[model samples]
Target: MLYYTIWTLFYSVNFHTSMVIMFSHINHKPFLGAIHDSLSLLFL
Candidate 1:
């Protein structure tokens, strides 16, 4: 159960990171910094 939980968390973060990257590519420059902040928040 613990392993499964960890895997899920990792997967979610990875997916979110990819989505954020894609959005940053197509969106404004400000959004890139905003997502970096968000990703740091997620890590914490």
Candidate 2:
């Protein structure tokens, strides 16, 4: 039971990390674009 619990926790953490990484990657370009646009607008 202890081993199973540990394994489950490990899998959950791994899955969560992968999801975060994937989401960051997916949004990275758009996020950068937004920042650039905002900065340019402020400068203008």
Flag regions of model 1 displaced more than 4 Å. 28-31, 34-44
TM-score of 2: 0.63
- Per-residue accuracy of model 1 over 1-44 as CA lDDT, tens digit each: 99999999999989888778776776755776859866787799
Q: Which stretches of candidate 2 lie over 4 Å from their true place?
A: 29-44
- lDDT of each structure? 0.81, 0.67
**CA error at residue 9 for candidate 1, angstroms:** 0.1
RMSD of each: 3.9, 11.0
Candidate 1 lands at a TM-score of 0.65
**Model 2, total clashes:** 0
| Cα lDDT tens digits for candidate 2, 1-44 | 99999999999888755655565567775555655654566589
